[model samples]
Every structure is written in structure tokens, then in C-alpha cells.
Target chain A: MTRVVARVIVTPKPVVNDPQGITVKQGLATLGFREVEDVRVGKYIEVSMEAESMHEARERVDAMCRQLLANHIIEDFHFEVDQVLHRDTHR
Target chain B: MTRVVARVIVTPKPVVNDPQGITVKQGLATLGFREVEDVRVGKYIEVSMEAESMHEARERVDAMCRQLLANHIIEDFHFEVDQVLHRDTHR
Candidate 1:
């Protein structure tokens, strides 16, 4: 089995009200970050899994994102999966 | 001034205890996702800014990440800045 690492990014849909983002924007303004604008906050998830192939890893991670990592009603998710080389094997 | 978008990723230090991640892992297991392991949760932030140059944007975004976007005491942050071209200019 190949060890795979998946990085998933989940963001609120454009129309969704992002109070957290707004709060952060206000905080930035208070901190004198005048150039900053349109700040949005989201979630980043990293998961490791064992799979038979890259294709399998990708499919599994995608399913995981859709089913558990993100809320389909208000969020969108994107992910990338990469194989990990075991240290013992690399030596 | 040039419009630039900055994408910042902030992740917890390896030594930090990630209760959120652990809870997610347990939830996945309950859902029969046995292959999932080593899950970590973090923050992803998108910031748009107006700057004189790419170099200036990068520097400003870096400072924002250091001062406001991330908690440096327990998290590490990385960011990328890219220029945004006006739609009218492209036409």
C-alpha cells in the first residue's frame, strides 16, 4: 500500500455571511493594516491514508471531503493528494 | 496601485495537541472511514490588498500574517501573493 497525504481546503461560498472573516477584517483595520481588504477565513485539513494507488487515494480523499470535511450547503472544498516516501525506503 | 490576492495557510505546531483534529478523526472512524489517519485541522485565509508592487504586497502580507493572520505562538504560516488583472483591461 502507498501512503498518501491529502491537503483539503474548505471555504465559505461567496454568498455566505462570514462573520469570522468580517471580525478578522475589523481586527486587521484596528492593527493598522490599511491595505488589507476583502479578507475571508476558511479551514485547511491534512489527512494521511493508505491506498493502493494515486487514483484510489484521490477518490477516497474526495469522498471524505464531500462526506465529512465540508458542509455542502455553505462551503466548497478542494484537495490534492500526494504519495509519501517512507524514510526507510528512501535510504 | 496594483491589486493583489494573498492566500495564507496557518497550521499548528507538531507539538501542539489538536483536539479538533482528534474529534474529526473519531467522527471519521464512526463513519467507517478506517483508512483515514493523522488528521490535522488549520486555518486558510484569503486577503486582497492594493499595493505599489508585488514586492510591497508580499512584504505587507507577510507582516499581516505575522501580526494578525496567525498565532505565531502555536502555529506556522505560509502565504503566496498574486496580482489580479482588471477584467476591463483584459478585454
Candidate 2:
């Protein structure tokens, strides 16, 4: 099996309301970053697993996103799957 | 002024413990994603701002990361700065 690492980025859909973004924007302004016009916050997840091939790895990661990693109603998700050498439980 | 968007990704240091990731890994396992070996969670932040140049934008965002976006003691961060067009308060 090929060791694969998938990096997933989950972002709120454009139509969703994100008060966290607003709070961060205000915080930046208070920190003297007045040039900042907007801010959006999202989640980044990295998963390492063993798969048969790159294609299978990507497919499995996509399924993981749909099933649990992302909330489809309010979030849009994407990921990059790559082959990694060795198997280390701690990263 | 140039309209710039800086995408910041903050990940926990390799040495730091990530219980959230562990919980997610267990959750995935319970969901029959038994091939998964490990998981890690982080933050994805998008910041849109005005700057004189790409270099300036990157520098400013780096400062923002150092100041508020990330905790250097336990996290590591990197960002990509790009030129964007127009201005929409929501997106």
C-alpha cells in the first residue's frame, strides 16, 4: 500500500454568515491593521493513510470530507492528496 | 494601492499534542475509515487588504500572523499573498 497524506481545506460558503470573520477583522483593525478589508476563517485538516494508489487515496479523502470533515450545507471543501515515504504515527 | 488577498495556514508544531486530531481520527475509524493512520487539524484564514505592492502585502500579513493570527509557541504559519480585483464586503 502507498502511504498518502491528504491536506483538506474547508471554507464557509459565500452565502453563509460568518461572525468569526467579522470579529477577526475588528481585531486586526484594533491591532492597527486598518488596511485589512475583509477576513474569512476556515478549517485545515491533514490526514495520513495507506491506500492502493493515488487515485484511490483522493477518492477516499473526498468521501471522508463529504461524510464528516465538511458540512455541505454551509461549507465548501477541497483537498490535495500526495504520496509520502515511511509511516510515522507522530507528525 | 493594490488589492491583495493573503491566505494564512496555521498548523500546530510537530512537537505539540493535538487531541482534536486524535478525536477526529477515532471518529473516522468508527465511521469505517479504518485505513486512516493519523490526522491533524489547523486553521485557514483569508485576509484581504490594500497594499502598495505584493512584497508589502506579504510582509504585512506576516506581521499579522506573528501578532494575532497564530501562537508561535505552539503553531507554525505561512501565507500566500496574491493580487485581487474589485472590492466586495461579503464573499
DockQ, Cα level, model 2: 0.89
Which residue runs of candidate 2 sit more than 4 Å off their true CA positions? Answer: A86-91, B86-91
Clashing pairs in 1: none
DockQ-derived CAPRI band for the predicted complex in model 1: high
i-RMSD of all predictions = 0.8, 0.5
* Backbone collisions counted per model: 0, 0
Tell me how far the alpha carbon of residue A40 in candidate 2 is from the true structure, in angstroms, after superposition.
0.4
Query: lDDT tens digits, residues A1-91, model 2?
Result: 9998999999999888889899999999999999998899999999989999999999899999999999999999989998887565444
TM-score of chain B of each: 0.90, 0.92
Candidate-wise lDDT, in order: 0.86, 0.92
lDDT of 1 at B65: 84
lDDT computed for candidate 1:
0.86
